[model samples]
Target: MASPQQYLNNPNVRKLLDVIASAEGVRHGYNTIFGNERFSNLSAHPNVRKSFRQTDGKTNFTTAAGRYQFLKGTWDGLSRQYNLKDFSPQSQDIGAIGLIMQKGALGDVLKGNYQAAIQKLGGTWASLPSSPYAQPKRSQAEINKLLGGSAQQGGYQPQYLSAKDEVRLFGKSQPQTIRQKYLSAEDEAKLFPQQQPPATRYLSAEDEVRLFQQSNQNTQQSSYLTPEQEAKLFPGG
Candidate 1:
């Protein structure tokens, strides 16, 4: 099983993570399977029904599990293909990439084909800006922000190409190592500063309950557990 640390060093994985981070943020530990408070069970959510191990007896609905919010059926197929051990943040990251590759969108992502990539991935992540399903949709600009493209400006910056190709296009190309082309610490820091990016936090069960209770009333209540459901989740108050 590849550890999160091991996956971290892989530039390809890091870049893919940037895409997920931009789309999902860290809400509900969207990109992590551990290292948070409340919702302690990374593999399951109290109000959610289905999990990789079992389904919640209350509602027969299948929960999208893990950081990438993969449904149990999806994870089952990916786990065997990738030999994943657990749904640790790293494992989940790997699983997501596998799905992207399966859809043939990895190259589009690396090449900064934001629209095409989003369209390809929309089938898997319903929240994608390109998805037809009605839900919170990420704008192409948000996705392009992480992709280092100019889509926000109505064009896309070409991804790092071969030095010869770069010279052919622009008459000059900065010397870059293969790894340097893929690694983007600056971009990661820009999107999610190390000091503290918005919404990534640890909360005690009480704090979590209170936080949700005080959340914006306008938000769709059905999207999250109701206070009554939460009370049932953490009983004996």
Candidate 2:
């Protein structure tokens, strides 16, 4: 049998392990952000720094709390190095959702009726809808429509165009540039809200080709099939 060090040294396996470790670290960090007592305490522990590094075949952290602290410190250090800031309420809520989803804890928490856990870990209790899964809140226009009012009455315009509009504006073959610009603008607006005006334009060569391929595939598949064939393929009439 291969030794643990030998297994870790294999290039392909090592890469896969690295990816898994990174994902695990992120999940742990997010969970810690929620209501994980061990992780929360460990993050603030002074001994955590000394324990994380293995030296001269000597391991650190004999206690569970010590190990947890070491892991939290390692994760927090990595987060700082990578500039990952989940300090905001919205960001923390999203982080908790991601952790819950990754760990398969959503159903368990919901079933247990751990309301305090849910509220503390997931942020505002009012944000939770009837559904167990987290969903995007309705846009102002959608809310207005639901209330039987026009979008203008809600004081917000739908600046984002539909996928169809995107394909029309930038031909299917060329979409990357426009898409990048749009994403950059959006990020800038998010980071510096006062600096960026609302932008509606989005044209990208890569996106165009992608969208076109999907649309074209749908069109081609539909064209040759009879209604009966389509019904058979899709199941529902």
lDDT winner among the candidates? 1
Q: How close is candidate 2 to the true structure, as a TM-score?
A: 0.18
The digit string of per-residue lDDT tens for model 1 on 1-237 reads: 432344445565566666765575446665333222135554532334532221223323445655666767788888888788776667777788888778877766556555676778888886577777544568877776766763324467546546654454445554554434332555445434655445423445666566578776775544354567557555643
> How do the residues 42-154 of candidate 2 rate in per-residue lDDT, one tens digit apiece?
22322323332233455544211221112344435434543435433233333333344343444434344233233332222212222232322223343333323421222
Model 2, residue 232: distance off in Å is: 75
In candidate 1, how many Å is residue 120 off?
1.0
Off by more than 4 A, model 2: 1-96, 113-237
Query: What's model 2's overall lDDT?
Result: 0.35
- On the 0 to 100 scale, the lDDT of residue 201 in model 1 is 32
CA lDDT, candidate 1, residue 179: 37
- Give each model a TM-score: 0.48, 0.18
Q: Best by TM-score, which number?
A: 1
lDDT of 1 at 127: 56
Error of 2 at 216 (Å): 99
Per-structure clash totals for the candidates: 0, 9
Off by over 4 Å in 1: 1-13, 28-38, 42-47, 50-62, 148-237
